[model samples]
Target: MQSFRTEIENPVVERDIIELEKKISLFRTGQIDEEKFRSLRLARGIYGQRQPGVQMIRIKLPYGKVTSEQLHRICKVSDEYSTGRLHITTRQDIQIHYVSLDRTPALWAELDKDDVTIREACGNTVRNITASETAGVDPREPFDVTPYADAAFRYMLRNPVGQEMGRKFKISFSSSEEDTALSYLHDLGFIAQIREENGTKVRGFKVLLGGGLGSQPRHADVVYEFLPTDQLIPFIEAVVRVFDRHGERAKRMKARMKFLISGIGLEAFMQLVEEEKTALPFKTYPIDHETYEKAQTLPNPPSVEVAEPTDESYLKWRKTNVFPQKQPGFYTLGIRVPLGDFRTDVARKLADLVKTYANNEIRFTLRQNIIIRDVKESLIAFFYQELKKLNMAAFGYNTTGDITACPGTDTCNLGIASSTGAAVVLEELIANEYPQYLYNSDLTIKISGCMNACGQHNMASIGFQGMSIKAGKLVLPALQVLLGGATLGGGQGIFADKVIKIPSKRGPEALRALLDDYEEHAQAEEAFHEYYQRLGQMYFYELLKPLSSTDNLAPYDFVDWGNEEEYVKAIGVGECAGVVIDLVATLLLEAEEKLSLAQESLAEKKWSDGIYHTYAAMVNAAKAILTSESINTNSYASIISSFDEHLVSSGKVSLGSTLSDIVYQIKTNEPTEAFAQNYLEDARRVFSGINAFREKEVNA
Candidate 1:
């Protein structure tokens, strides 16, 4: 790889890029294990695509906020390293595809120049911190969550406590009681709230814990009705610590925080979080929101004589795609990018438009669309004309006609069928046949390549999950139709029900049946989920079962969407959460690395960070030894106990105290400098003892 080390201004980021280059070199020369290298690259936002030798880089944009200059930088990187096309993800990040793995370091260096990042965009860390795109401007919001979200993202970006865990942790901040950010579906969700206390107003949040959507979805439990704003980051840190200690590791499917909390019960999980509070560095980490509250210097509205178009299409677009901000005389314009895919040429033009006319800021929505904020009311006509020139002024920004779908079989290894292909057909059907639904916000449609729900299929009113069905002697692509899902606001939601399965080619037909049935049904002015509940799941199943027939299958039905050949069921190992390799030598090496980090933190006088790093090092050493014994070490807590039972009790290794008492000290004592120093020494001793024992065994 060509050197671009001097391009990065931040020394820490510079080292990170250089380290990635070194690791890639090591992996290429067979010095680094593939699984270990996979984890390393994933933390930097390099993800494996279905196609080999090329990668998809996810550029992390906290709360979906992107400056025009940053967008231009992203487009430049896309053009230089990969295809000049960008895909906005449901998590509010941008992914560019088909780039050589060798160029990732340079790509990252380029993005960092504009203060953009891809760190923790993937892997078992805190993923992108998302919030309502209308956060600052939403009239219903008590306070803007942009500052709080940015603070959380900065704090957790490279925190040692969340560096590696059994599974990824997702966090969201909703703008208001409407819960537009979908707080209920996250691992740790905060809904902005405020209440009066003795004639003084104070900001806080309604906290939700442990919700997830997949093959089996769970609703998050309300842990607190109102947690003070200052305690938000501290509370989040405690929860992450507890999860890292107790979360499942052996069972990949059950490794999510939702499963762990459900297995242990929410009450017990809260107790664990409470227990970890003392180890936290802050009792109340106050965020500086005054800076964010400061008024931005927006562009002056240029005087123009052009009149607003009187066409029905423009009128409908105005009603649906334009929203008024809390700041009077300003509007936010939503641009519907179908399937979250757009060309770089259009992106550059959009960036220029926003920089010149709007607030120079654009936010990618959770529904995989873009919104330009703080546009003057007078410039609406001018902006619309400019956007129309770029072919980006399409109607139905986030309505029934705007379907959200993942890049299923097109790029994902776990994809069973072509979700993007199916989405195109369904969207076209809605545009041509169901134009009346364009203004309807009561129903939603989402599709995923598989049960993983990356496209958020389970949370939509009408959802489809990719699958396959065997008919007679042949296999064909299929979709699992889901219904009755909706968000009820205030941190509450319902996951869609799996109504029936049908051939992939019939996805559009199935949607047509559902919409047609709803249009002709008895109820007046009923929402889609409510209509489904009124009739029940069995009714929809029976209604769509006719389309599930495989008896009269055509030759085209055997082929998946967007394909010309016969369908083949080929599934690759997914790297969504990064793989875990239990190689004994690798684990020991990881233990040594953790000890070095612990020492570094102690030297820097970060007491709490040092103590946590020490705890991790001790646990890693224990897990390393237990892996050699072939014992089940599913969680860090289990690793501690199993180490005691299998090795410590057997007199094979000797620590001054039991491993639990030493490791669990983190939960008991405060993270004082004295404790941090003692903890680091303990970790070093434990790792040295384990290393000596392993060396003796190797020598024998």
Candidate 2:
């Protein structure tokens, strides 16, 4: 096996790589030309993930569909550039990882040849436009959203207005009620709907805006109950313009569309949207109706007709995993990709199977599962047989839901523990002890190796975050249990409240106990999040109190949560580096030249030393910003501006300031350290000013 260090030394000499690296070096030197920087960043796979080192490269598949040829291209990229795995994110985007600094541009060109792109996939610009994977094929859907999604994508792909925003923008479309598109969590979520008036079916969409997840999670608000599909592009453009002009830019965390909607009440926001829409050029162009029709026409699936009388094993698999499509004699089988991961071999085999038993149609679900739609009822048995052969036939849907986990300590630099490992254990426990739970209830058990919430733990009914605690003298793994998060019905989804912090070793048992409690106490037919909501915080606090012992926790305390049992697992040891400012500085510098100042100051140091220095700089910067602020009306921007001025004047960047600046500057102009410190000083200030603003109406 070749070492990563060796691979780094033996750089791939692709054309894009040379140009991309030059631009990256230029950006690092603070000599960034915005246009060039954008081009390079997009050209390369450098995306701003919730964490450092880890870059979320969005591989664009026009109309949310990919061919086996495209799939192979992606697989090659995954194996060559990333972790030999691909992640199908909720936004209908394929995210590859462990990408090197130099190989990105080459990867982009490789994808470009296949008509896929990563342009504007990240940055404070329009991200990959997403549509329902089953857009045209799902018969229950009112209309194929593929065209609409494509139109929106084309319109926004390089729109001058989308060049820079207060924060990154996400858009998604759901053609039906399956809600697989995760419309509620996007910055702008659109669901295709139809209205029949005077015996005419008018195409329209229910538009949602300002919903997202991170440290603060909020569900999008419906700005328009219904707007004609033809008007969607303009409507979306209007919303983008509104967000661009008025969205909070000084405070990165508070700059998301959700915060904007929360600040001005949703109704007022809607009124603003309506006002914007009226002023905008509402034009409809010629859509490729032929292409859309072709997409809608189900390709004849390969003939592998099975005899009647389904095998019992296949029947059980179908009963547990297959979802009935509105199409007669057709189904969408869920192939559980546990921990939202799969080997490249498995991916290749699955792609082959799709070409064979299915109609060469495969849909990747946000749950990290794959749906092979257009599978004829007769071929179900053969499909299961092939799936079992490939070791991809796990009947783990909705029971343990395959444990929606991020590539935690194994691959992410920001992860606190082995999230994937935790997920595997959790899924195993549920599968072995309470197999009935898989069928009887709809439970979402999500885990993030860290608090960045990449795993969407904050939105799960029962969420867990990996951390460490000091068990007297030794450090031990621990997990934070978050209760009452859900995203079921398109409203602002509530974040799970942290009720208990227990050892990672005890996570499975603790979860089982919690599930048992839920089963015992929940009202008949109540959903997990709903039942937890009715139970309230007190009941959960008391129920999990016994698991909160710190006897076997870690000793290192990176975050001051005031709990000796809770510590941030040190960075560098995890799969992905932890959120160390030095690492972020290096990445920022490598991505663009302007970040060279911070990079030069902190480069070539040991990870621990670099982190400590970064932390101190951030603290000093925050203090400077806060001290400079006018007590009465100091906005986030004012503090950040003050901090930047201080950094320039003093020629010193503190650890806290570095961390805070990166985080805060991403949204607002506020100094990151000041914002964080302010949150600590007055929890309500953080809540009312940002948290509550983002999550004002979410059911807690």
Candidate 3:
């Protein structure tokens, strides 16, 4: 294996890259097991793709903020290590697909030069932190949530409590009550708020928790109607700590925070979080607003003869795709990049455009669009013309025509159908026939290749989740149509109701029928969600029932969109790396890895880190032993108790004390160097005992 070179000045980042390079070598040689290696790589934002022999690298961009330099760096990295295409995810992260696994360390090192990261962008860690793109410029926002969002991202990135979780956790910050960030469906959400108390104004947030969208979608509950801004990080850290201990692990489908809250009740979860306050590093984590409040605007460009746009299309574009900022004489332009798919060449052009005309920074939106801020009022037409050259000046920025979609069958392993394909079909349908709908902000159309809702289809006014329907003896590509979903503002939203299933070929027609019915029968100025509620689910079901027919289906019905070949049936149960692992050896290897980390932390005199590493080592070893006996190890909590019951009680293993007593010392003891050293030694002793028992079992 060749050594990867990194010029990163930070010791932490250099070590991280070196560790990844080392793990890649070990994994290639089969020295490290697949499951353990998967987790390690995922923490560094390396994810498996539908295509074999390659990876999908998610470049973490906090709040979707990207400077021109970073954008250029990303494009260069994409061209060098992957296909020359940049894919923007709904989470505000950029994904470059078909990257060689061996080149990832070098690719990461390149990105680091521009201060961009891929760390914690994938896997069961806290994913990228997202915020409303309009956060800083929103006229109605209490304050810019960018700094707060930035603080949250900084605190959680590689934080011990969030590094390895039961499942990926999502967080969001809404700029205003409009909740443009869609706080309703996040694991934890913060809505900017301010209140007058005794002649003084206080900054705070309306915090929502336990919300998620997947096979089962749940709206977040307001954990705090008003929580002081200073307490935000501490509260979230406590919650994450509680989740780390109690969240589900064995069942991937049931491992989200929503499931934990649903299973144990929100009150119980909150109580557990309250108990974790003692272990948190901070009682108050105040965000210094100056970090983002300093200067977010660029100087106005020099005077130029900007011709007035005479084209009717340009007028329509300005109406829907442009907005005035709270800052006087400035505006933000929304660039609708269809399906969030843009080539690297265009991305470089966009970077140059931003630097030349608008602010050097552009935000990738949650709607899978780009928002360019601080454009002078006079340069609107000029900006529009420049954007047109890149083929990105579409009229509907967040309207019905701008569909949000995940990279379905194109690259995602979990994709059941071609979401991007269906999205293109739907976009054309709207643009050609319903051009008037471009101004309709009340309507949202989203598509997901599967029920996981990566496309966030469940939260759209008209939603399509990828599915396949059995037609007699033949299986055909299909979509499950859902209706009535909408964000009601103030962190309130509705999850769409499932209406019916139809062939993917007829998705456009089904959409036509639904829109036509709403146009004909809805009351004056009726919102989509309101109209759906007024008319009820059964009404829309009957209207779309005609398109749901399987009779007299053509050959085209079996073939999905954006494919030349006939579509084979797919249930979207994409391959999981965990299931393919040799669980026993993988568990042992993970234990050894944790022990290594413990020693490294102790050597650095980091008591808390060393203690935590030791705790993780003990848990890992116990889990390996429990897995050997085929016991239920659903979570870290389960592993500890099961180790005592299946091994200690059975006399299959002994240390003269229960494994519970040995591990639980982490919670009771102070995180001093002496205690950390003792814990590390205990973990080493346990690892030896487990390995010796494994040897004896093999001999037998």
Candidate 4:
């Protein structure tokens, strides 16, 4: 286990891995609290699966971009440390399941050699930064969002402000006004734009804030019509700072930024962001777009004689899966990864093919598919022939027939039913019976194992959420049918409305009913959502309500899709957003750890980072004392007030001024070296006072 430690080259990453190894040792020995250990492991992208003693590791790929070498490295790690299968997520991350918990540090070390990472992939941190797959290659894009997304990912990867937050935060970038990245559903969404002022073309973004989807979906509000490129990072930093300070902590479901904004109002939230600007290190952080402006190294021509495909299937694949790039004579080939699961053997061959005939780069799509860029126009047939052999050349790249689904009962602990299983049956039903829908781009179908919406089912034209229903004394798997959701470009969208619930066995029947009704009554050239809106949600409910009956059920109705055995409801506790129980001792230990990090940042001359670390240390110490008092607190803002009221007013722990006065200095003062040093010293004194009081009280 220790052998791979020495192989890591980056000192920061090596230290992170070593700390993980140490924490794992502590956890094994029962020295660390299970809840705290879960939080730690999750930040490293090691997620607990439904099955015990195994983990599902999420490999974070910023903006879904992966080079051939990186793909090769991921394949190697999956084969060595996990099952050979890779599951692509809607966020464009690749997950490998059934991995041993002890081998994760070594696995991470191996991936680091190829500049790949898993950190912050599945936790209450800044999750993977995603963008449109066609960012650089899209013909309508004003300028590529790749560099900006990369900058945000890099700036927030190990940033202290987001290391531990109320809940996970998501960010996305759209290539154009098309909003292909689904920016309306993200916490922070940016749509690329360019404006000409005084004969100078200034690149900027139309920024949206506080958007999210789950049980309650909220469309993002426009925060900025035009925010210059230079201010992107600073604005993000300010917002995260505000969220960390005032966002909910105790209520797991309400901890999202969307809820915070909804509760406090956007005007109040922006005021907090404005107050944080004084402490920001950069007022205008410039991104290096020139670095990404360089041309990609194109592949050489194919050497072997490959026959051109003239079959009907080939023509359909060409029409559906091939896209013309902005670069002349170059095309992008789309591979529809069903349920986003592909084996390492297929991955290795795809990697080789990209290196041989494309730009040696691939971007996993938000729809959980793969896009190969810079393929020469003449080589499209060759690529298709090669992909067909791998069983990855299916048509309907992003059409109605191409369904998006999460790994439900297959791997997710929180799964209520088999989403991937049901998805397979539905896709087969569409291909066999409703083949015309394959060419329809106006409709989408997405399925989630549960209402958590990991499959993004709530945002599709047609959606299904896995659920359970009772018939007399027996229980059966069911799906909550949703309809009328669609994304309108330029930061506008609508969440699907739940229409009805039907047995899992009758999902195909429900889909058929919806499609048939739309075809029968819809006006010419009307979209699915428009047709549904024209009729109304209750109208579709009545049409499919017949399939909801359980009285005529057969024996197969008792079983979930893709399963041979009878259904047994085994929903496990999810670790994605664990509710942390703070023990006083544990909180103090964390406070000390933060102090150490603050010292390290100060030594490295990172004033802003050091200041944030110092601020967190003070808050941790206060929360520890409050926990000892049985005074439960939620937000960090509450912790400060509670500490001041309970301890300071009672004269139990004395400081020169109010707790708020000292802590709010982070917002009032500039993050200069002198202020950072002073803040660290103040944190040390505050922690010492609290520790002394706690020890004395315990002794007494």
The lDDT values for all models are 0.90, 0.63, 0.86, 0.92
TM-score of model number 4 = 0.99
lDDT of 1: 0.90
> lDDT score, residue 467, model 3?
83
Give residue 580's error in model 1 in angstroms: 1.6
Per-model C-alpha RMSD: 1.2, 13.1, 2.0, 1.1
In model 3, what is the error at residue 98, expressed in angstroms? 1.4
- Output the lDDT of residue 432, model 1: 99
TM-score for model 3?
Answer: 0.96
TM-score of each: 0.99, 0.73, 0.96, 0.99
Better of 3 and 4 by lDDT: 4
Compared with the true structure, the alpha-carbon lDDT of candidate 4 equals: 0.92
Give the range where candidate 2 is weakest over 10 consecutive residues by summed lDDT: 574-583
Which scores greater on lDDT, model 2 or model 4?
A: 4
Report the C-alpha lDDT of model 3 over 1-700, residue by residue, as the tens digit. Answer: 3344637767778878888998899989988877677878888999888878889999999999999999999999999898899988999999999999999989988899899999999888888999999988889999999999999999887777787787888999999999999888999999999999999989999999999988789999999999999999989888887787788888777888899999999999999887776555567887889756876645667665779798987998899988999899999999998889899999999899888887798999998899999989998998888888888888878898899999888888878778999999899989999887888888999999988888999999999998888989888888999999999999999999999999999999998898888889999999999999999999988898889888879998888999988888644324331222237877787778888887888898877777777787788788787778778778888888888888878888866688888887876666777888888888888888778888788789
